[model samples]
Target: MAEAQEDEKVGGFLGWIERTGNKLPDPVVIFFYLALVLIAISVVCALAGLTALHPTQVNADGNPLVVMSQSLLSGENIAKFWVEMTKTFSHFHPLGYVLVVMLGAGVAERSGLFGAAMRAALGNAPKVILTPMVALIAMIANHAADAAYVVMIPLAGIMFHAAGRHPIAGIAAAFAGVSGGFSANILPGQLDVLLFGITEIAVEGSQLDPSWTMNVAGNWWFIFVLTFIYLPVIWYVTDKIIEPRLAKTPFSNTASADESVQDPSAKLSSNEKKGLNRAGLALLLVVGVWLVMTFGPGTPLIDEPACPAAVEAEGQCAAVQRLAPFFKSLVGGFMVLFLGAGWAYGSAVGTVKNHRDLVSMMAEGMRDMGYYLVLAFAAAHFVALFNWSNLGLIFAIHGAAGIEASGLPLPIAMGLIVLLSATLNLFVGSASAKWALLAPVLVPMLMLLGVSPEGATAIYRVGDGATNIITPLMVYFPLVLVFARRWSKDFGLGSLTAMMIPYSVWMLVTGLLLVVLWVFLGLDLGPAAPIAYSLPGN
Candidate 1:
């Protein structure tokens, strides 16, 4: 009854959000509409002579170059759009990155390696530390991508039930870590590749820093720290807040006899054990290969020979330039790791008898991405249209100017960015889609204000993650609700949203504080990625 009152209270605001959000069109349709709006706006801005002083470019007179907004509705732009439509979608920066990663991820997930690995991590955890253990594994399981939601959430519920705790508490902890801590993983994964790929495009389009390139590990340290920060947050929220609230909520045993037969406490079978062993070996072998390629023989991943003589004469090549190849190679490296590990594990467990099965798994993964492909097409055109119109850069320059004139501290400015991202997440759930729309403006705007693109990306991630669990718009929110319903039949959408509210609030606060601290300390975002950026001439 207390839980009912609590749900009603929180549901008022979130209910409005859910209703309004459901009324909106699909993300792909949203992109198409946004593109149409951008065209109209571009026509108006161009006719009104909107322009900005280019930050990096100079005229023949050595003055800052003045850039005029171009109308996307113009004959030239319309022609270009029609001619380049295919190229735009095909060359979309994140398209290949996500597809490539999903190929390997599909095999690993289908072969049951990802599920077994998550189960193994939480299988024997002590009751005393079960919340933290679930939190930790949930964060790490982000490498499994969307599979984490399917495998970990229910498994956590079962594990908690077996431990005599409220299963909802377990589900909350796992959901918090999986979605709320989405970007807080120890190792760089597909999200890094996807977001940073967008960041790279934004930076290049802005022409803010010609030297800036995408580093998949650019947020390694930030996310590594975030993992620890979120671990305690989830642990405390689960044990101290959510569990107490859920304690009186009666759990209805909804499982069938066959479903109940698969006890989570049961030990792994011999085949599962053998598969895990082989998977570990295969993973290590992949790492070993990357290590040798990076550090041995000619050091192929390093570009010492390509160092400019001006820098080489000073002693060594710039670290970032030298290690560029290694960073670019990590995308493929991760694919190989998942592919090899899954294949090895599947072979040991009889999931993969030959190459045909492996190919089938890869194809299945691609099939899962059909929706993303359609969304990507619309998003690619929208982004390309924005870039061609020159409005993204114009707005960024003007926005940066306004921010600078306000005399706001950089940390405060970044905190606002995080807030903006969190608020937007309630409305727009796809991280890549939101980033696609925001990056061209936010990345370049922050860059103009002396914040690194990486810094902007990092903060955006923090905001994007914190509100995911509470937002009905998030693609997997319904799936998570279904998982919760299995343990408690009365668990409605409001119940799930209310249960996750504390996690969302705490995570957003914690993440904002961390971003502020990171900016004030001037810490590196990742290897060779700083929190501060400067225009080249500056």
Candidate 2:
């Protein structure tokens, strides 16, 4: 009853958000509509003589180059768009990254390697520390990306119920860690490659820093710190606030016996134990191969000749420049890691028998990605249209000029970015799609303000993650509600959102402060990723 009252109070505002968000078109449709809008806007801007001085480019006379808006409706651009449509979608930077990672991830998940690993991590955890343990594992489970949602959340409920605690509280804790702390992983993974790849495109398109390239670990340190910061937040919210509120609510297991949910506290089968042991060994071997390629006789992953003369003048190549090849190779490394580890586990557990089974697993993964492929097609065209329109760069330059003229402090500027991203996440749930749209403008705008591309990406991540739990638009929100309903059949959207509001509120506040502090301290976001950038030749 108390929970219901609380839900009503929180529902007033968030309910409106839910309704409005639901009315919005599908993300793919939104991108298609946005591309149409960009075309119309470009036509007007081109006619109105819209232009911005290119920050890094100069004409033959050594004057700043004038970037003019190009009308998408013009004859040449229309032909170019149709001619390059296939190439544009196929070459979309994040397309291959996500697909490749998911190929291996599909095998690991279907082979039960991912599920077994998550269960083993949380199964034996002590009750006193179960909340934090669940929180930590949930965050780390993001390496498995969306697969974590299906495997971890339900298992958490079972573990909590077995421990004589409210299962809803366990689900809340895991959900909070997984979605609310989406960007707070201890190590870089597929998301790193995806977001940074987009960042690279934004940089290249802006022509701001030709030397700038994507680093998968760009936000490594920031996210590493975020993991520890978010763990206690989840722990305290679950144990003290959410659980006590739910203590009066009656608990019932409404799920049928045949449901796939498992009692993780139960002992593992002999074959499962053997599979886990083999999976670990296989993962180690994969890492060893990468190490050998990186450090062996030829140093295959090192680009010695690509080192900058500026760094050479300092007597050594910068660590970032030296390891550029290695960093890029992480994409393939992750694919191989998941594939090899999963194949080993499957072989041990009899889920896989030979190369034919492996080929089948890869195909299944691609089939699951059909929706993403469609969405990517729309998003790729939208980005391509935006770049051709010149509005993205124009708006960025003018916006940066306004900021510069107003003398807004860099920290405050970044804080506003976090707020903007949080607001937008309520409407668009796909992180990659959201970043693809925002990166072109935000990355270049922040770069003009002397902020690094990685810094801009980090700030956006903080906002993108914190609001994910409260928003019904998030793709996983309804799925998580189903998990919650297995325990409390009467639970509604309002109830779940209300329960998660505290986690979202506290996380947003903590994340904003951390980002501001990072800016003030002038800290490195990751290896060779500084919080500030100076325009070349400045």
> Which prediction has the highest lDDT against the true structure?
1
**lDDT per model vs. reference:** 0.90, 0.88
Worst 10 residues of 1 by lDDT: 254-263
Candidate 2 error regions (>4 Å): 1-11, 253-258, 308-311, 315-317
Residues 103-193, candidate 1: write the lDDT tens digits.
9989999998998888778888998899999999999999998779988888888888888888888889999999999999999998998
Query: C-alpha displacement of 143 in model 1, angstroms?
Result: 1.3
Worst 10 residues of 2 by lDDT: 3-12
Clash pairs, model 1 backbone: none
Give the distance in Å from residue 266's predicted Cα in candidate 2 to where it truly belongs.
0.9
Write one digit per residue (lDDT tens) for candidate 2, span 314-389.
8655567788888888888888889998999999888998989988998998899999899888888888888888
How does candidate 1 score on lDDT?
Answer: 0.90
